[model samples]
Target: MDEISLLEQGVSFVLHIDQHLFALVAEYGAWLYAFLFLIVFCETGLVVTPFLPGDSLLFAAGTVAGAGHLSYPLCMAVLLGAAVLGDAVNYEIGRHVGPSIFSRETRFLNKQHLLKAHAFYERHGGKAIILARFIPIVRTFAPFVAGIALMSPVKFLSFNITGAILWVAGLVSAGYFLGNIPVVKNNFSVVIYGIIIVSVLPVVIEFIRANLKK
Candidate 1:
């Protein structure tokens, strides 16, 4: 598919994850768990796939689970594992490529994003690993930048695991509890957009702050 079509499909999925995800779970049955795992993995693990649904998907999954369509424990476990493993793989890839990779530009990779993530890492140090988990594009690039900076594997793993757990659990649990409310369930699109806005707020604030400093 072309870029515009791909973008549109992704947006649609995120906005209507409730309906699309329910149909997926219903049709795929047990395999839906694996599918979700792959989606989460790609979104966090691959820089080029940052546009893939992340926060919204998890929320929708939790909503479905709350409705008794899927097992919450199993859903949580699968996604959490995918997220941790994805970051580990991304970090390893960056470590192998080193900092030089960031100097080169490609259609799939954005240099500005790498620079922003690198700066975020430098300013926040180790905490950037956890903080980036809440930001969309940065979340994908943070581990790679950490690896380029040659962060210790043990140190990276500690924060990576912690962030993954907190991110997945917090969003999913919120959907489970809040999504079940009559108002929320009836107007889930609004809640999903709210989640998206809140998720990206940090990046927006940082962008503004950087410009102000300039």
Candidate 2:
């Protein structure tokens, strides 16, 4: 497929991840674990790929595990590792070159998103590392911003590990426990949409609050 076609397919897959994940698990079996790891890693690790699925992906993985197609402990471990490692890489990149790239919005980098993440980090301090895990774009940039601000490695790692554990375990557990229910199963797409909305709701509120002050 061409780039545009591939991009379209990717967008569709993310939007309907609950369905696509099932197909992935069925076709790839054990390899699905690696796929999940990559998706989680890139989504958290790369600044430009924030649009990738995170919250819904975990939840869908949990649901798959709940169906006995995958192992819960293994899923949690792989995803948690991916999340932490991704942030660590992103932090390092930021520490090394944040100033140069952040000077202007490049074709790939969105300066506004970085600024928003920086503002969040400023307001919440180290806690933003934990809180940003639940927010979409902010989570992708929070660690990078932290690195730019010269946050200590020990402190960033502590918060990064804690946030990854909570983010993976909480959402995955929710899906494991609830995703197979008749209501959720029949309306899986709706549930994914709900998860995305809930994940970004804080950002929406923050934006509104910021505008009100302006």
Clashing pairs in 2: none
How does each model score on lDDT? 0.90, 0.91
As a TM-score, model 2 comes out at 0.94
| Tens digits of lDDT, candidate 2, 101-180 | 77766999889999999999999999999999999999999999999999999999999999999999999999888989
All-Cα superposition RMSD per candidate: 1.3, 1.8
Among these predictions, the greatest TM-score belongs to 1
State the displacement of the C-alpha of residue 151, model 1, in Å, after optimal TM-score superposition: 0.4
Which consecutive 10 residues in model 2 have the weakest lDDT in total? 10-19
**Per-residue lDDT of model 1, residues 77-150, tens digit only:** 99999999999998998898847676676887888888888999999999999999999989999999999889
Candidate 2 deviant stretches above 4 angstroms = 1-11
**What is the Cα-based TM-score of model 1?**
0.96
After TM-score superposition, the amount by which residue 165's alpha carbon in candidate 1 deviates from its true location, in angstroms, is: 1.1
Candidate 2 lDDT score relative to the true structure: 0.91
